[model samples]
Target: MLEKIKNNFNTQTWVLIPIAIAINIAIGQLVLVLKLPVFLDSIGTVLVAVLCGPWAGALTGALSNTIWGIAIDPSAFPWWPVAAMIGYMAGRMAQWGFFKSWWKVVVTGFVVAITAAIVSTPIAVYLFGGITASGSSFITAYLLQTGQGIWSAVVSTSFLTEPVDKITTAMLAFAIVQGLPRRTIGGYPKPEQVEVEGGEGEGGANNTQMYIAIGVVVLLVLFAAFMLRNILGG
Candidate 1:
């Protein structure tokens, strides 16, 4: 794991981060205005999770959400990390093949969506309500405009959104990995020893590098979309 961590920060990975940040910001803002059901923000988190597992996912998630939280309200400090954690968990689950099948994806979606709603709604209510004692006004306006109780609206949104976000994220991550160079993914599957023996090791580092580079690139794309939305537009 430590070795993997060391490798994850290779020159290529470092280059990708800032570029990804810029792209995510742009995309995130555009999507918000377009009111797309799919969110590009969580893709970086998902890629991190897929490539480096949950820890990487957590970092990606937190950063992405923090940027977004600042846009929503400066007082939403507490909620950012929480939301990021949720993003991390979703990515981790997807990595575990939670979305391997359509049925599985549907089931995973239901579970994640509900959990996001339960965890996220109250925080939103609190934050939107002026962060004061009488949060009643904030809650009232939210509910009135939606024509549903705040809880219902939030919960429904969560249920509907989580699946769309997770599935798309998972699919994108998979596609990026497939498209990347081979060494980038796993060091070439032992190409050196494969001298007619098998393509087991050595020589294929280049392929692995490509896979890694591609994965890193995908992560950046996600980050750029998110950053654009939170900073430039917001």
Candidate 2:
């Protein structure tokens, strides 16, 4: 296990971690400032997970939130576990070959989102009382006001918010990896994890997959909006 973990780190992996952390903080802070319901913070974390390894991804996620909390936003401190688990789950899914194509990347993202929701539920409940500083807390607050249990409210909020953010993050990361030159991507610990399985020389498959992914994203957005309207209106 130690060897497996050790194999994930290389000169390139080390270089990428700080860059990933920076990306996480910059985008995360921007989302906070904009007060967007979806957090686009984990794009970098997913990037590292697909390229490097789960441990490296976890480190990037944890450090990303830690630095963001200490230097930029204090509220980000308590959510490091959620971020760490996102990274870990993304990397594990990648290792299992889920990052190979755009549709597979979507699956990876959904799995990571579910993992994040489960890991975050306790923190949101016990630490923040089902209301963190996140924009999604508004949903949780509404649920609570409607007499929903704290845990249920928080989990529901996570289910609604995390999939959109995480799926987007995973797709974006997959696009970035797909755009990279073969030689450039080869330096990563898990380059095979992102290989376009069907046909490399041909371009049609990638485009089709991307289009399908976009359609899925649109449907998810509509579904989330409908759910929010119904829950808040009812």
Q: Pick the candidate with the highest lDDT.
A: 2
Q: Write the per-residue lDDT of candidate 2 for residues 1-234, one digit (tens) a residue.
A: 999899889999999999999988788778879987667998898899889999999989999999888998788899899899999999999889898877888899899999999999999889987888867788999999999999899999888888888998898888888888999999999888887777556443367878998899889989989999999999
Q: Pick the candidate with the highest TM-score.
A: 2
User: For each candidate, what TM-score against the reference?
Assistant: 0.54, 0.94
In the order shown, the candidates' Cα RMSDs to the true structure are 11.5, 1.7
Candidate 2 clash pair list: none
Residue 93 in candidate 1, Cα distance off native in Å: 1.3
lDDT of 1 by residue, 41-136 (tens): 655555555454444556655665666557654444565565466555654565566533333433444455455557766875666632223232
Error of 2 at 154 (Å): 0.6
